[model samples]
Target: MAADKPTAEAVAEQLARLREDYQARLPAELAALTALAAGFGGAESDRARLDELHHRLHKLAGSGGTFGFTALSARTRTLEQQSKQWLAGSLDEVEAQAWQSLAAEVAALGETLNKVSPPQAPAILSARDSLTSDETVQIWLVEDDASLAEQLRRQLESFGYTVRHFMQIGDAEAAAHTQRPDMLIMDILFPQQGENATEVLALRPILRALGCPLLFMSSCDDFESRARVARLGAAGYFLKPLDVPRLVNRMTQILDQLRAPPQRVLIVDDDVALAAHYRLVLLAAGMEAEALHEPQAIIETVAAFRPELVLMDLHMPNYSGPELAGVIRQHERWASLPIVYLSAETDLDQQIEAMGRGADDFLTKPISDAQLVAAVRARVDRARQLDAQITRDSLTGLLKHASIKEALEITVTQARRHGKPVTVAMLDIDHFKSVNDTYGHAAGDVVISSVAMLLRQCLRMSDIIGRYGGEEFVAVLPECAGGDAQMLMEDIRRRFAAIAFSYSGQAFSCTLSAGLASTAQYPEFSGAELLVVADEALYAAKRGGRNQIRTASPHPLQEADRP
Candidate 1:
């Protein structure tokens, strides 16, 4: 028989089962330990008994967190340490300390264990799922009123959402069992006037555990009602009657958050095995990860990987982790990149010292797999979200208007310093207003999104592209003249014109006109000046004929200097 390996999901399921078994069996174990402690004698005869009790505490300390009961595990570790001192002939310490302290600690741990909920399998996001950005968002609505449900469904559908309505919580729960929506919109009021659905949901916590972003609307908008929704971790709560447009806008924002690309992580550890292990763990969890075993390659790897977070190992042969973090921070571009130290150093003072040198956080090694994933994911997600707010366009995935301009200015300054050419293209979709007038604004949006997708597909990784407001795109191409940029724009124009868009069963196509200005044509022009020149050429292209590329002429001085 071939050797079989368990899938990650299977491993997580097994771990969950093991964790549940551990939680269920904990109270009995704690009671037994207390029973043994109560009858303890400080004599040789009690050695084995004390050892056994100490052993049990040790096992709980090590295994509790591994099985997901980190609090219980930590408490057990403290008890185990106290017990160890007694078992190793320092029995007076335990006897000196009020026996009540140990008893109280054990009781407190038991209480925590008793309150532990059922173990849930760790959520795993696959590589394909993470890479498939902009997955169509699905929304499930739980509203008993059919008219309101239908109205919201139509409104959401118009915004390209797949909306499902559930008249009863049971139906929604059943649908969730089959297919979980990306988000949920629910009403706290049902047919029963006084029965708030939020209260009912609190009783049945399954919906909350499914982990979709939640939004709730309620006629009762009191503090108590808001507090109840807050406990459920709702993304938004609206007062009824709900504002459809505002709700749709909130839903879109949530969807954008969900559809953002997986965070990229760079692991810098001298131990190749450990780094590779971390990489696999992150990649299997639907993150982009690269590992660097050599400290010398840190800067290069970070530059190429463009990581949202860096996992640094404290001790390395070539340099210290904190020193490396400080080095990375010296580079202005990477100043804010999240750098977390991952090492076996457990001394709080030392960890704090490392963090003082520019590290964001310090996580001791031997952390549980789940804890590691959660830690890194939380950091990377926050870092990326913060970055997106500054660097990304809200409507399209292209660079934000100001960000692209900043990027272009930087590129232009570099080109000037190096005496290299760079091209800036200004593009506008031909007759875009007519598309909105003819079909609808929704159709116009589709056309704009389609063109954005095409540009992303065709642009070089080094090239910079941005959405300069509605139906206008600007792209920066390094080391290319206006002629070359125009050629590239012509190809984009052709490809975009070929994309067939449909609204209400009526198919149509759209095209774009472009203008290109190059540093070669006007060597002294700044990035902003180049943009103005490009925009002028774009208008000329539009006036000459729609759906064409126009290149700006070289400066008269530059033409004479060219010889």
Candidate 2:
């Protein structure tokens, strides 16, 4: 009979059970398989024993495959095939070595099977459920009736509306206050256990203060009730047992009406009235606009507001807009912050000077609303795309190495300034060279990839891991003390040592050693100094034992303390 199929976790548990259940049989099984593969060349009786061994492996394969122990099943199948060739007298010495290797592989695969936990199910099941596009709308639903609420929730989810449901009006209000949800849907006849409708009417003041569009749902069919709701600033009213299709269509229409292009404009003019007029024009177009009278605050304000584009007047009190553009360009952070001049001085030489000073494009003082909107949107979109590429790692889907390093350095500096602790760890795989030598380079690549995944799994999301070089990784742990760092390193060491790699019908295992250094006691030390200390401790670990962790001494080692 086939063994029952097991989940990944169950498979691991079964391996552990097997280790204990067949403890005495394991060594004998290994010995038999090894002897069968090695082939007792001159003995006829031993050849018969090999045939029996081949049958034993075949049974193991059939049972293991049914039980979801795939690695074991696969290894056994390969061994079974090789054993048949041996019985037919067609297998060579090199092929014999390959079969003998499978015994060791099965042992290692069993060890790995014993270590792994099951993979997690995805948090979200559908692409539409995940917020991938800016065009997708989010709606907040506040309803108390369980059945009706569930009906609406399912319909909205199916329609790709990111919906958040709340049972209590108070809870809904709290959420909206904190997150500023795009739209709100509330029930007017909110159930009252003991309190009267008058007390519920008091909630209208609080709701009005939210400033977002509100839609009310009720069963009341009177004109007086509809007028009252309109007074409460509700955009629309809907009846109970809602026409869900019509409601959804209306909601989509409402969102589309509200979906004006993001309006964020910077006005850099000394003339307050003219800047205010431009601000009025931009605001009328549904844009957020800021007017800056002081040319000196250009860089600071730009950094803070991140205005989509700047509109500057060429002639200013203290500095010309063209000169201010030149100053803003000098700041590396704001170098790409788009600037456009709104100058009355439209002389060809003046426009040339403005463009030369890094103004992306020039517009005369009498700029139309359409031209202004198009120019700003184009520049802002380009800037966002560039920022996304700059921050991402092309290879591993983690932060780019350079960006993470810069962030770590800033964190280290902040920790130093704030009198907090920081720890850095350097991890290296033990005897990685041997893996490449025994297996092909492709197998070596697998080992490296597996190690990278293991490191990512072991560390906290807050902790940063970067590929330091080939076969080495670095992690920066903010606010971690020396003792905590040691504990974390040990956990990583144990987890990494547990991973096994399978290739070419052979299974291999590897371990990692780490060195940790903290800047708690050594407050004056730089990030580079912390790295040096960690690297030295790593070398010490290699010298003492390959799979262990060594922490840097609090104080420098004396001459006699050196190895």
Highest TM-score: give the candidate number.
1
Listing every candidate in turn, what is its Cα RMSD in Å to the true structure after a full C-alpha superposition? 19.9, 32.2
- Of candidate 1, the 10-residue stretch with the lowest lDDT total is 125-134
User: Model 1 lDDT vs. the true structure?
Assistant: 0.75
Q: Supply the global lDDT for candidate 2.
A: 0.66
Q: By summed lDDT, which 10 consecutive residues of candidate 2 come out lowest?
A: 125-134
lDDT of 2 by residue, 1-563 (tens): 55566676697887878756654454456544543433332223235445766798888777667655675677678768876776787333323224434433433333323222343222322232233212234577878787788777765554445678888777766654324455778776665544212245455455455556777788887887788777676778898757544465456556644543354678988889888988877755545577989877877777765676787888887898788888888888778777877766446788887788898877765767787766666666676557757875433334566776676688799778777788988888899999889997777766665555555544543477776766777888877877889997887777556554556667677788887888875677787888888888888888877899888876665213325
TM-score of each: 0.46, 0.40
Error of 1 at 473 (Å): 9.0
Residue pairs that clash (backbone atoms under 3 angstroms), model 1: none
